[model samples]
Target chain A: MMPTSPVIPLFVAVPLAGAFAIALLGKKTRIIPNGMALIVTGGLIAFSIIAMRMFSLFGVHTYKLGAWPAPFGIVMVLDGLTAFMLFTVSLIAFLVILFSISYMERYSGRWQFYTLFLLMVAGMNGVIVTGDMFNLFVFLEVAAVASYALVAFGTEKHELEAAFKYAVMGSVGSLFVLLAIVWLYSYTSTLNMADMALALQAAGSTRVALVTGVLLLTGFALKAAIVPFHAWLPDAHPSAPAPISAMLSGVLIKALGVYAICRVFYSVLGVSPQLSMLLMVLGVVSMSVGVLLALRQWDLKRLLAYSSISQIGYIMLGIGIGTPLGFMAALFHLFNHSVFKSLLFLGSGAVEYATGTRDLREMGGLGKRMKLTSAAMLSGSMSVAGIPPFAGFWSKLLIIVAAVQAGYYWFAIIAVVASMLTLSYVMRIMRYGFLGELREKWAGVREVPFMMKLSLGLLALICILGGLLLLPGAREFFLTQAARTFSVGTQLASRILGGV
Target chain B: MSKERQPGMTLIVKTVTRLTVGLILLYGIYVVTHGHLTPGGGFAGGVVIALSLVHLMLAFGGDVAFKTLSKSGAAVLEAIGALLFVGIAIIGFGWAGFFFNFLPKGTPFDLFSAGIIPLCNIAISLKVGAGLFSVVIAIVFLRVAGSERE
Candidate 1:
């Protein structure tokens, strides 16, 4: 059964209202911004969990705006895939915001930071929930604009330069997206994703649809920081404050880039074999190249930034396989990566917060002093590098097994080699930054403040337990359901439109 | 000769701006209220309203504009405008569905018709006007800060 829930719209509405409220009231008292951010994000996390449960029970839930019928007015759909994304985005956002409470005190304009952060969250939620293509682009812009400002929040020379480059690259990407939307609209005379899917399915694989797909692929790939289009990420990610880095690396790329690709190609355009091959090639290249670059970086955050590109490759490779098992692996990897990557970024933030530096050469042996943070970093590293019992290992193994099952032996080989490369660079960070002897200059470094530690501890705990998500019962609830959305392909339109 | 030493444009430009700024503001309001009936809606009207303030700032110095609406004041108004717009949507959600436009659609071409649209337009105008004005104010301040550094 398809249910209609009044609460669907609040996913976008509440954070928006919170952003403005912070802008208005945040100046009056310091506590208001902190309290409001916590409340908003915490509420969103609960709502998303409820949404996931609702999806499991109901199949697909859609809400029409202004009480209008689907195809004519905007709709917010909460299918298994969307519910999964909402849960991932909201969970990470809550943790990042918690970390920011302490981490951001070094910078001024606490109010502005909260306002922009909430706005970005609202935008991501909007993107996840909206059933309209144009609405997705609008929400994408909202998030992108907010992030650009946040990147330049420090106003340092390097920060400003990185932000400018990011804004330019990001705008060019958006232009491509807008152009693709225009092309799709002209071809189908509809901006709604489900409607467009039905239209294109009727129209078949025309030249126009092909062009639109290529355009969209180019656009979202840029946003996702696929290797060739990833010039801005290494600079921008490290340049932003730590929590912002966590948000950018953890969920922003997935929500804005990978999810869009999955929805557009698999559901709307109906992925062609050629497109699948292209995605696999991009995935492999990004995986190898990203780790190679990271192996050379001495900056803690920049190394992590490069690692993000490599990890994203693993998700993309899974998606490119285009099998049910492959889809499940991709979604599983996506969730696992979000948890552990954000944990890693937050752990780096803790180090920076304590030591006032990000260079690996300057720091050593703080593991004894900052026991919790080092432990958190260790778990995050183990998970990301695909060690046994960590979340990343299961997902990466699944992807390789699925690839081999599908007879793509070469892709499987590449994925394994990349996994080894991941371990190498991750170990480098541990050895240079955390594992060695204590530096004389950093002797006074204490653990970060309580809020920061709490956030790190919670995310690290998730990293350790994340493997449980792949257990039989839990897999059926989350991964299987989300993967089904992709496997259903163009039939998704019929499911949604028929439900309405 | 003394007037020429002022921080603004020539006296004639200032005088003309003073005479015309009120009219521009009125015209902007007219566009906003008549949005549902005419082509110019909230965004167009809002741009016009902001232009009036920009005219004031351009004619005199930013000081004169700051006196009328300080930076913080503009920020407050921008937030209020956004809240008002969202509030209307929430009210609609409460009444029916999200953005349901719950208010009555009165007689076509009538002043009080179109229910919440006019209210929405007013809210947008407040938001855009203040938002654009503040953007300009920020750029102006940035220039001042840069000059001071130099």
Candidate 2:
């Protein structure tokens, strides 16, 4: 049996404590909530790294809640994929929290923001770690509810409207997920995902399973904002305060949406060829449609939001190929997108903080005045546009290679064209938002504070060097292990059960 | 006549609320404590408790409600309640394991049985009661503020 670690529950516990503490003590002093959020997210980053190390030592560690054995009670599984997701979520979260330190000064009710932010982090951590399907659903709601509240944090006309629309669609998606879980529970007679997988294997694929898969795909697609279900994202993402925008576009969608879909499809439901093909089609549509919509946008954050959909499409397309290489590429892109996109969002926040505008036409020659934000934006844009020597290029290259190897030449061509489209809009952002003549009104625009700059600089550096993760030494412990977890598929159940 | 004409409802509703709100709160506590053995638990009991507070607000209006509990106080209580729940779960680590049920298990029907379950119920009730009441107060105050802005 894999030795149970007591530290597993702390992943969810620490953040919950921080969030509540913020609510209670935040009223007393502003610094308390700020310090509390930083410490909690920073501590989580350390814990995720530790978890990654633990996975290296002991392949899969399962912590059964209430000291109960698996298949009987709720279990938190710490595997390669879980560690990867935990690290990604906590790392970006810490940076975003840091970026918010000065960025949130203009807003009222700072405590509420920190409280909700930590709650969302806790929920994502819970979703990643939990081994039970229903437990995942609960955490998913926790994250979703917090995001809805955060989206309306500004209390503006558009903010409220976007939040309401987002909430309605999110609730509908959650209902579909809940319905799928109910169907799965009825069919498999188990709540534990590993146990359910074994049960489904024993029973073989049924019509009920097929229905459950379709329902789950639709639900997660809505969460991930893939193509048709993406109406709310352009509105909701930009409506939030910028740090939240970063969280929403950066890790939230991937953690609550893409990560859940991956875990459920690969490990639990077992990806079928038809399912793979369907995912590819959706990915292509999301890619082409997202950028086409983005090309017409002048609002800075809104364009980035649309670009987020496009990037998520790339990740999804990588997964759709259904090879070990495909899994690796998807995961790499997932991590890379989280970094660069959050950086971009934070950069936009800095610009808005300085210039007080999100419209691209209103900004110019920011490259002269706001040197740090401009540089960060340049790095982020370069990374996202698949330029050489940046992280995005490597992942996009791998994805294309994977597609070509899989004999889907059309998919490879679509990915290439999408990359070119990505370059065009990103260049537009640089040209209009930064490169041109300094606007008269923005002459006095100053750089953001130290903390925001630190966040931006760190993320920009990562964006530039993110390709090093694919090197032989780091690849084994990080990406390779995560890829192997998915490649094994239904065998995950047997491994977990056998280990216990 | 002036007292009755205060911003709230008539004296009849206020009198009824004053008398019954305490009883409702007491019953909520009872349900929370006996949650391990009874059908009602933290969530239901907490809702009942919050409803009693809401009952007071609806009868006497927000001024009286704010005086008793206040927005900040309710926030503190909710936070404490949540922290308490998490703390209890953490304390389980010292006994059996993470989230292990370590409390003394007496007879099934006993009020004090299922050790930590009762504690957890109390914590949850604290959170739910305060949280629900605070949400109501915020919305009510929001309307008040909106009017003030106009």
Candidate 3:
């Protein structure tokens, strides 16, 4: 067994501390919040890297809070999957915070923005690292509550309306999650995930387990914004400030929605064939419906929001395949989507920042004026549309390949069709927003500030190099390790419990 | 001051609030300190403490509440409370582990027993009390600003 690494808890601790510190000291000067946010996020990235290294070395490490033993006290687990998620979340959070330095200047209460941002980061990290069921719910709510407040930060009529909708929907999702946790707790008589997994296995599959599964699936599905549950996403994503938009679409949904589904279903509940089929169906519907809707949106952020739902469909399809290749592809696609989607959102934000409008029709030939931003947008668009040599292409190809290998040829064909649809809507943005004649009024438009450009450029670079993660050495080191965690299925209970 | 001319409610309400608010605040502190031995902990105690201030504001008006604890003061206290709580947990790293109870456990059922539990409760109460007060103040002030605009 691997010895516990002390740095594990800092993932949640550092951000929570930074948030409170910013709230207290930020009022004294503007620089305090900015400096604190940068330091905290930067520190988190370092810590996540350390955690990844630790995971590679130790296999699986668990930290028992307050020196309490497993099954009694809260434990934080850091395995390949947790480390992978930690890296993704922290990397995006650092860039978003970097982007926000300039992007949030237009809004008042910069301090509040930083505080909420850090709190959300803390919550996401908590969710990723927690080993207990109730603890996960608590952290999920923390992230959810912070995102809700951030969505309403602008306080405009539309922003307020969207935030209200998001809060109401998010609350309902959280209620379902809490109820499921309560039910699970009652059934297992323990909140520790490993113990509960063992207990569930001993009891075998029953009606209560089935009901809890449905409740959990519905709750996380709502958070993940899978198709029918995606009503609040389009409005909520666009209403927040640009950096916030990037953060929400980029990492929040994946962390809260997709990651939760994967962990709970695969590791705890143990996915059955029925559950797998249901997930695949959900993925296909979300993909086709989301892109079809995106084709009609005029607002840049709104279009991207819809695209997120579709891309999430790709990930769900990969996961539902339930093959080792499928798991790897899903995780690969998830990472690629995070980097490129964030780049896309930041690009949109830059466009809005320069032109004071989000309507695609109003933005014409922006590529000529804002060279850097447009280039970043192009990289993001191409990557997301699955053009060759880009990160998105590799992941999507893997998903389709995995589907076909699993004898789901129809699912493969649908995935291909969705890919084409994704390309069409993305091209629509490029044609209308960037390639056409320069608007007469936008003659004075310029590239975004240095920090925003830097973040965009860095994310664009990641998007370009994202496929390299599939290289044999890197693949074995990273993606395979994460997939192995899930491929073991319910045996994950013994794996984690053994560490204690 | 005349009853009707006061900024807040009637004279009887103000008198009653004045008489009870101190007792409520004291009780909340007791509850927080005695959390390890009793049903009420930081959350409940903090709510009660915040309600004491809320009771003050609802009776004597915003002016009186501001004099007791301003909005910024509540916000600062809230932040401080959170920092203190997290700090206590982080400090545990130097000992056995994160959130490890490093303090000596006195005697069970005693006021100072339970090691770090009382400290944690105090910190949580501070945060909850200040946070609740600030939330209420924000809502009340927004409402007042809205009504005055009309």
lDDT of model 1 at position B142:
94
User: Each candidate: RMSD to true structure?
Assistant: 1.1, 1.3, 1.0
Tens-place lDDT per residue, model 1, A316-381, is: 999999899999999999998999999999999899999888999888898978999999999999
Query: For residues A1-500, could you state the per-residue lDDT of candidate 2 as single tens digits?
Result: 87677767889999999999888888768899899999999999999999999988988889988888888989999888999999999999999999999999999999999999999999999999999999999999999999999999999999999999999999999999999999999888899999999898888878888999999999999999999999999999999999999999999999988999999998899889999999998999999999999999999999999999999999999999998899899999999999999999999999999988999998989999999999999999999999999999999999999999999999999999999999999999999999989888888889989999999999999999999999997999889898888888878888888877
Best by DockQ: 3
Itemize residue pairs with steric clashes in candidate 3.
Answer: none
* lDDT, model 1, position A284: 92
By DockQ rank, best first, the candidates go 3, 1, 2
- Candidates 1 and 3: which is better by lDDT? 3
lDDT scores for all predictions?
0.92, 0.92, 0.93
| Candidate 2 residue lDDT tens string, B1-150 | 687559788888889889998999999988888888879999999999899889888998877887878887888889999999998888888987666789888889888788788889999998999999988988988898999999
For each model, chain A TM-score? 0.99, 0.99, 0.99
Task: Give DockQ: model 2.
Answer: 0.82
Tell me how each candidate scores on DockQ against the true complex: 0.84, 0.82, 0.94
